[model samples]
Target chain A: DTAVSQTPKYLVTQMGNDKSIKCEQNLGHDTMYWYKQDSKKFLKIMFSYNNKELIINETVPNRFSPKSPDKAHLNLHINSLELGDSAVYFCASSHSTANTGELFFGEGSRLTVL
Target chain B: AQSVTQPDIHITVSEGASLELRCNYSYGATPYLFWYVQSPGQGLQLLLKYFSGDTLVQGIKGFEAEFKRSQSSFNLRKPSVHWSDAAEYFCAVGPFGSGSARQLTFGSGTQLTVLP
Candidate 1:
């Protein structure tokens, strides 16, 4: 069974279009995160939520919004997507108190804006 | 701000040769370090992590990382490289805290290529 899963493995849309990517984790972790990997393979954190509470919100554009309806799901919604947004988006989860600092990632969602 | 640096952007080695990937970080206090491997079309997999205690940490797939506090480095090593081990490796650093949220900062990955 997949511990973490993300929907729409590939997404292609025109500029200014809006899209949403859903993520879920069955590991029962309290914290979930969203990361963006650019073409240069530099991964950066975008947002983090703990038990449906927003914790870290990087300097990302306001167009990118993260919503956690419940503990098991955290979805990313992108509005007014630009060509610069063409990259891989990854969803990850981890236990809150575990000092291991190990993150379980989901299959990335590749978004290409034309 | 915490940051990670991977010196080698791409590395290629013979199938039976030894391999080492260098990772360095800058943090104010003791940092939580991790090594993750990413195969094509798949998510990142946790290979190993170092919180404290022994500097040397063993991970799956015959991978090990040594944390050298003096050098501010955590380097991953493999005794013998296999063709199947060709993948992108990422080094991450996170703050040591008990909060329910711990966000990781990842380095620009190093791509490994094993030549048979």
Candidate 2:
């Protein structure tokens, strides 16, 4: 069983189109995160949720919104995506909101906005 | 705020040769450090982490990292390299205790190309 799974492993859409990526973790973790990896392979944290509560928002654009319906799921929705939104998005989960735990990451969803 | 820096953008090593990837971090107090690896078209995998004592921490696939508080470095090392080890490595740092941001700041990854 995959610990962390992300839907739509690959997404290709127009610049103005909107898309959503869903993430679920079976690890029974209390914290989940969304990270963006740019073309240069620089990974940046976009959002984090702990037990369905928004814990951290890294000053991402308004177009990017994260919703966590429950503790085991966190979904990202991009509105009016731009060309620069072409990047890989990874969903990860940890035991808690503390910094000492390890993050189990999903395979990742590669998004390409044309 | 915490930040991580991976000085080497790319590294090449021959199979069976030893390898070392350097990682540096900046923070006010003791920081939680981690080393993650990412294969082609894959997500990041935790290699090793430095939380407290035992500066030299071992990880999966015969990998180890030493945390040096004096130099703010947590460098990963492997005795022998395999072609399968060719991938990107990332270093991340986070605040250790409470009353701080609970996010891991990752560095610009270093791509490893193992030669035959």
Candidate 3:
């Protein structure tokens, strides 16, 4: 079974359009995270939720919001997407809320804004 | 705050040759270090990690890393290189015991190119 999965493996949208990427993990983990990989292959943590509670929120812009309905699901929504928002978004999960554990990542969703 | 640095942006190795990727980190205390590999069009996969035990850690795909506290570095090495091993490697560091910081800081990443 796929440990972690994300919907819409590829997304191409116009500027100013709003889109959401849904993620689900069956690893039965308590912590889920959203990460952005820019064109330079720089991976940065966007947000993290532990048991549906907001745990980590980086300095991401307000237009980017993360919603965790449950421990197994965490979704990312971006409003009025800008060109800078074009990047690969990854969903990952770990056994605990601690960052010391290894994370299981999904295939990732590639977002392109034009 | 913790940060990771991968000095080599790209490295090319011939098939069957040994490989070593360097990674340095900056943290106040003992940190949790990890090496992750990302193939083309795929997510990151944990290759190995260093917590507290033996400085040398064995991971999948015949990859291993040694934690050198003196240098604040955890470098990944492999005995032999395969074309399939060509991918992007990332080094990450996380606070060891700080409960407040629950995120890992990843390095820019090193792209491995295995030549036939």
Candidate 4:
């Protein structure tokens, strides 16, 4: 079974359109995260939720919202997507809420906005 | 702010030769360090991590890293590399805390090319 999975492996949408990416983890982890990898291959953390509680919210714009309905799932919804939103979004999870844990990442969803 | 720095953007090596990927970091305290590898069209995989204990940490696929507090660096190394080992390597640093540390600051990845 896949430990961490994300839907919509590839997304191509027009500007101003709204989109959502769903993520699920079966590792029974408490912390789930959303990361964005730009064209330069720089992975930056956008948000993190621990046990369904919002914990880390980076400098991401308000247009990006992360919802953690439960400990096993964390989804990302982008409103008013623009050309700058084109990048690879990855969903990751760790076994514990502690920072010492290693993250298991999903295959990542490539989003291309025109 | 915590940050990870990977000096080389790309490196080419010969198969059966050794490999070392450099990674430096800037953090307040002893930070949680990690090395991850990503193949083409795949998610990142953890090669190794360092929390506290031994400075030299061993990881899967014959990979290892040594954390140096004096240098503020965690460098990944392998004795012999196969063609399959060619991938993008990333160095990341987490804060020193229970909850906040999960927010990782990753360096620009280094791409490895193995020549015949």
Whose TM-score is greatest here? 1
Runs off by more than 4 Å, candidate 1? none
lDDT of 1 by residue, B1-116 (tens): 88899999999999999999999999878889999999988889999988889999999999999999999999999999999999999999887666412657888999999999
Give the clash count for each candidate. Answer: 0, 0, 0, 0
Estimated TM-score per prediction? 0.96, 0.95, 0.95, 0.93
Worst lDDT 10-window in candidate 1 chain B: B95-104
**Lowest lDDT 10-residue stretch of candidate 1 chain A:** A94-103
By DockQ, who's the top model here?
1
How should the candidates be ordered by TM-score, best one leading?
A: 1, 3, 2, 4
- Candidate order by decreasing lDDT: 1, 3, 4, 2
- Of models 1 and 2, which has the larger DockQ? 1
Instruction: Tell me the alpha-carbon RMSD of every candidate.
Output: 1.2, 1.7, 1.7, 1.6
Candidate 2 chain A lowest-lDDT run of ten: A94-103
Q: Write one digit per residue (lDDT tens) for candidate 3, span B1-116.
A: 77899999999999999999999999887788999999999999989988898999999999999999999999999999999999999999886653423567899999999999
Of candidates 4 and 3, the better by DockQ: 4
What DockQ, on C-alphas, does every prediction get? 0.64, 0.52, 0.52, 0.61
Docking quality of model 3: it rates as: medium
TM-score of model 1 relative to the true fold?
0.96
Model 3 spans with C-alpha error above 4 angstroms: A97-100, B97-101
Write candidate 2's Cα lDDT for A1-114 as tens digits.
Answer: 999999999999999999999999998988889999899998888999988999889989999999999999999999999999999999998877454657889999999999
Residues A53-108 of candidate 3: C-alpha lDDT, one tens digit per residue: 99889999999989998999999999999999999999998866454568889999
How far off is each candidate at the interface, as Cα RMSD in Å? 2.1, 2.9, 3.0, 2.1
